[model samples]
Target: MGMSYRRYLYGERVYGCSKCKTHLATIHSMISRAFNGQHGRAYLFESVVNIVEGEPCDRPMTTGNHTVRDIYCIKCNTTLGWKYDKAYEVSQRYKEGKFILERNLLVDVQ
Candidate 1:
């Protein structure tokens, strides 16, 4: 394997992994706040960094079934959330290629 480089995000509001405080995403990249995760409330993000994704698997969610891959913090290996690969419901298709970061597992690093 090659060396892995972590990206740092600079902005007014930065969300990071609670365990390692690694930069994940900024407020400007946030898509929505009314989402739920395994831990509790979550936020949907247009993009995120400094994380690794696991294999994609089909999971049923409140909106519908989706093919998602669990995302983990690259610095601390903490499971932060998941990334939507495919949405089964047309109404939920907007979430595909987006990411979810649990509020309970995040910290305001900025």
Candidate 2:
């Protein structure tokens, strides 16, 4: 079954990652998707819990759909997420200035 984002949004707490347990983003900050990002799929997220490290580079991302910097877990070097240094879509513009984490990608501990 798919994860219930709504529960995490209303529930007391949430956590991240099965391997490292790094405190990632929250459900409250989640922005629902509308067809973009990886594989032309719609991606969603907002702020993170503990700050992570981003390795910015010139390489284009998601089929040059975005100018991106890869984010990693400071402690374990696991790829926590990324940020859009620049975006090609207006719908993506709001997130362009923010970090999009994969808390949902990880195992939610709440």
Candidate 3:
């Protein structure tokens, strides 16, 4: 028999809009930071998430007037994750360490 090649799709398992999927990397990073004791320390690179063709936001998403170094998805307009200046604040106040790795995000997975 000829070589049977199996196509293996190696990428984010996006169940929602493409924009949300695109920010998987950033989300993962934020989760990692939180796990590592870096809380509320999100960085948003691009401007605030914009309303894309497929994705629409009920209300404008704001970074709480905080400038970060992370990028948001254009499709879903979800605040995937962020690296904020108030890392200490998050570490102290926020009950959760990371935002992306929160239980809510994994509701479908479970």
Pick the lDDT winner: 1
Q: Residues 1-110, candidate 3, lDDT per residue (tens digit)?
A: 56433222223431222333332332323223223212333332222222222222222123223223332344444544433333324433342222322222221110
Q: If ranked by lDDT, best first, what sequence of candidates would result?
A: 1, 2, 3
CA lDDT for candidate 3 = 0.29
Q: Which stretches of candidate 3 lie over 4 Å from their true place?
A: 1-23, 26-71, 85-103, 106-110
Tens-digit lDDT string for candidate 2 (1-110): 65423212224556565476655656676676543543344345666555455666554544446777876665566765676677776665675756655534466665
Q: Which prediction has more favorable TM-score, 1 or 2?
A: 1
Best by TM-score: 1
| Deviation of model 2 at 62, angstroms | 5.4
lDDT of 3 at 30: 27
In candidate 1, position 58 carries an lDDT of 98
| TM-scores for all predictions | 0.98, 0.62, 0.26
Backbone clashes under 3 angstroms, per model: 0, 0, 14
